[model samples]
Structures are given as C-alpha cells and as structure tokens.
Target: MRAVFVRPGGGGVEVRDVDVPEIGEGEILVRMRVCGIDGTDLEKAFGRPITPPMLGHEVAGEVVESKTSEFRPGDRVFVHHHVFCGRCYYCLHGSYTMCPLFLKTTIEPCGLAEYFRVPRTNVERGAVLKLPDNVGWEEAAFIEPSACVLRAINRAGFRPGDSVSIVGVGPTGAIFIRLLKSFGASVVAAADLSSFRLEAARRLGADIVVNPLEADFPEECRGATDGRGVDIGVLATPTVKPLQTVLDTIRKGGVLLIFGAPEKGEKAEIDFSKLFLRETNIVTSYSTSEVETNLMLSLIASGRVSLRDLITHRFRLEEAEEAFQTARDAGRSLKVVVEA
Candidate 1:
C-alpha cells in the first residue's frame, strides 16, 4: 500500500510504500476513493505538526473487509475521523468533541492512503455511515468539513436574516457562506487577500466581497449593515492581524466565531475595554460530532448543497507534493482532493 507521509521538520509530504494495516477483530478496512485536503494537512506538511505521521482526514470510500455484522464488503461509506463516548460527562453536556475518547482514536496510517482501518470502537458507537447512491465521492468527502461548519454555526447562535462578515475566504469560509445562506443570513460579505478564494465565495453566494488590500475590511463590513456592523464576524483564517481586527467588524453584542485554530501559545492582544463595553461575545468550535455528520450527509444526499463545485483540484496518491504546494497558495486553488 502507498500512503502520504508528512516529512519530519516542516518540509512537505512524501508518498511511500508501506504494508497494509491488519484490521482488528471488530474493525473494517476501507478502500479509499477520494480524500479531501484540509488546511490542517497543509499545516502539517509545511507548518507545525498537529497529528502524528498522519495528515489527511476528510475520507470517503468503500468497505473492503468487515468483521462486524453491521457492514459488508463493497459498502460505500463516509468515515468520521473522531468518535466520542456518548456516556461521558462532556458528551452528556453536548460538548461531544471535548470527550477524551474522541481525541484518542483515528484511522490507521491516515486518510491519505490507498486503504485504512476503522476501529471497532468507532463502529459500535456509530461513527460510520453508508453514502447515499446519488452522492459522489466528492460530496461524501464533504461530510467531515460540513459537519464542522455546522457545529460552529450552531454554537454561535446563528439565526435567520442575520448578517455575517467572513474574514478569510478559504475553503472553510466558502462552506460558511454556503451554509449561512441556507440558514437565511441576509448579508454575506467575505474578506480575503486571495482573488481565487474571493471568487469562490462569490459563487458560493457571498452577497459582497472585499479585498483587505484595496479597502478597510472592517469598515466595508460595517457599511453593508447600515454602519452598525454585521450581526456576526467569523475569523476563518485566524491570522494574527485578523484576530485583532475582526472585533471591529461586528455590531455591539454581536458574536465573533473563531473557526480557525491557532497554534499553541499564539497570542494577540485585544482592546478589553471595547470588548467589555460592547458586550462582544467570543465563541469557538472544534471538530464534528455524529449529530452534524448525519445532517450533513442528508444535505448532500438531497442535493440541498453541492460540493463538486468547491473541489477545484484533484491529484493521485503519488502527487502529494504538488497537491500540498497548490494548497499552500490560496491564490490558485480552493478545495484540493487526492484520489485513490
């Protein structure tokens, strides 16, 4: 088998031959169809590492071997990378992602491989689902990311007719735009340095788009909302500057959803007085739970949302380096996929 490995010391990805993982008693081996490249994969390839050896996570495939009665060979599916123990306190409190068990398990090797294993713990807890017949590999590949975006929107208390300013129009921001519109958000303006991403946001239904280089993003977002500011501001990229500047782009008492995860100890100072006086609330989201994954799959199955358009680049397993390079330059690509 061949898998993409993140080279040590912040270099890039490498495709190497490796022995296929042996499935455990209750596990299933999945034959990869397509795997979606996320920002974290690029981070692992060129920046600091988040997960070990493994990188990619957005996976969709067919069951090649099943040891449990719940699945059979040739069954098409979308496998979640994380599964939480529903019996835990964190799970009981609706913070499923915070459950300790959720963080400990993952597919063997990585999602960016010819094949991988789904553990029994994940299967017993319902972390796997059969892809609908109409859903293509690209759409199934969206299950994880869409589930993540759904979690953020739900936690942020988003409502119909609310206006939102999305800072950093990358793949994640594009998902936010599409979902916010479906949720009935009225004004959706995106701010980014990349014209390629901005155009992608426009296609995804962003009502207005602005480049931070050409204009004041905060001011432009405020202008679209009668000078009061948008109801919500999303810092999608979590760049040091945007972390400090997005606060000025929303209305008093509005919400700021930090969807991007910054590296450990990466700090940015903010105006405490302004934050307190305005009653600005900061909310964050991490990972996806089975709750949103089910809904996301349905959304794609029903054709309520289309993901094929978001995937602008595709590569084979051997083209890992080129794929990571294109993903690094946001000016050229949106969603990059690696096929089996």
Candidate 2:
C-alpha cells in the first residue's frame, strides 16, 4: 500500500510504499477512495502538537476487508477520525474528544494510505457511516470537516434568524456559511484577506462579503447588522488578530466561536474590561464526534449542503506534496483531495 507520512520531527511528508494495515479483531480495513487534505494535516507536517504518522482523517472509502459482521467487504464508508476510550470520564460524559486516550491515538498511517484500519470503537459504536449512493467519494470526504463546523455552530448556540459574521473563508468557513444559511440565518457576512475566498463565500451563501485588507471588516459587519453587531461571530482563521476582530464585532451579549486551531503558543491581546462590562460568551470547538459526523452525512445526503462545490482539486496519493502545496497556496483552492 502507498501512504504519505511525516518524519518524526518537523519535516515534510513523503510518499512511501508501506504495508497495508492489518485489522485486529473487530477492526475493519477500508480501501480509500479519497482523502481530504486539511489545515491540521499542514500543522502535523510542521510538527505541531500532533505526533508523527499524521496525514489524513477526512476519508471516504470502500471496505476491502473486515472482521466485524456489521460491515461487509464491499460497503462504502466514512471513517470518524478519532478513537475514544469508552471507560474514560470524558467519554462517560459524552465529551469524547476530551478523553486523554482519544488524544493519544492517531488515524495515520491514516486515510491517506491506499488502505487504512478502522478501530473497534469507531466500528461498533456507529462512528463509521455508510455513504449514500448519491454522495460521490469526493463529496463524502467533506463529512469530517463539515461535522466539525456543525459542532462549532451548535456550540455557539446559533438560533434561527441570528445574524452571523464569519472571519476567514477557507473550506471550513465556507461550510459554516452554507450551514448557517440553511439554519435560517438572515444575515451572513464573510471576511477574508483573499478575494478568491471571499467570492467563494458569497457563492456558498454569504449575504455580504468583506475584504479585510480593503475595508474596516468589523465595522462593516456591524453596519450590516444595523449597529447591534452580529449575533454570532465565527473565527475560522488561525491568526490571533482575526480572533480579536471576531470578539470586537460581536454584540455585547453575542457569542464568539473560535473554530480554527491556531499554532501552539499562539496568543491574542483581548480587552478584559470590555468582556466584563458586556456579557460576552467565548467558546471553542475542537474535533467532531460520531453524532455530528452522522448528522453531517445526513445533511449531505439530503442535499442541504453540496460537498461538490467545496472540492477544488484532486491528486493521486503519490502527489500528496503537490496537494498540500495547492492547499497552502491561497487563491488556488477551496478544498484539495487525494484519491487512491
């Protein structure tokens, strides 16, 4: 099997001929059809908090082998990236991503490989979902990221008719725009430094688009919201300054959802006095859970969110480096996928 893997330290990824992962009892082996390249994959390549063997998580594939009776050898499925210990306190409380064991596990030799193994927890607990016939492999790859955005929107307590401003129009941010609009958000404003991303956001259902480099973004969002500021602000960029801008643009009692993962040790200068004076709520969403992934798949199957619109590029497994470069280069992509 061919796989893309990162070196132990901070180094670039390389394509290598590796052995196909062997499934243990209760495990299932998937022959990957497509793997989505994400921001986290970039972080792992540079030796951010994630350990080595990192490559992909958002995967859509067909089952080539399995030891479990619930799934057969020909089922098309989407793998939930994380594995949680059912006995952990976090898992007991339904906060699976917070489980220490979950944080330690790596999906790599992940979905980027020609074939990957699905853990027993993911298989038996319904984390792995069968893709509908209408959903193509490329679109199915978006389930993971869409699920993360869904979780973030839920955490922000987004209500129908809420005014929302999303800072950053990357793949995840675009998904946020679509989901917010589907949920009845009347006013959706998107801010980004790149004109290409801003345009993509508009096509994805943003009511207004603002280029932060060309205008006062926070002020523009406020103006669009009739001076009350947006009801919710989603910080989808890793930059600390954008996060600050999100906090600044939200209404006094508005919610600020930090959905993007910043580099380690990243910090922002926030006004503590203003936070105290105005009842502002700050929340952050990390990864997605099984429940969210299922719901995202359902939404895709229902045509509420079209994953086809998000895909911008596709590469073979051997072209992993080029795929990463395409994703890294702004104005070039909405999402890049590696097909096996």
The C-alpha stretches of model 1 lying farther than 4 A from their native spots are 50-53
On TM-score, the candidate that comes out on top is 1
User: How do all models score by TM-score?
Assistant: 0.97, 0.95
- Give the per-residue lDDT of model 1 (tens digit) for 1-340: 9999887566898888989999988899999999999877877787654444467899999999999998999999999988999988998999899999987978888899999999999888888999978999988888899899999998999999999998987788888998898889989989899888888888888988888888898888788889988888898993556876678888999998898766556778999999999999999888899999999999889988777788889999899899989877898998889997
What CA RMSD would you report for each candidate? 1.2, 1.6
Model 2 per-residue lDDT tens digits across residues 1-340: 7898875565677889988888889989999999998878877776354333467999989998989988999999999867677788889997877888766665546888999988787777677899889988988988999899988898889989999999988888888888888889989999998888888987887888988778887898888888889999999985667877888779989998888778778778888999878789998889988878989899999987776678889899999888888887668788889988
Taking all chains together, the TM-score of candidate 2 against the true structure is: 0.95
Residue pairs in collision within model 1: none
Judged by whole-model lDDT over C-alpha atoms, candidate 1 comes out at: 0.87
Candidate 2 segments exceeding 4 Å error: 50-53
CA lDDT of 93 in candidate 1?
94
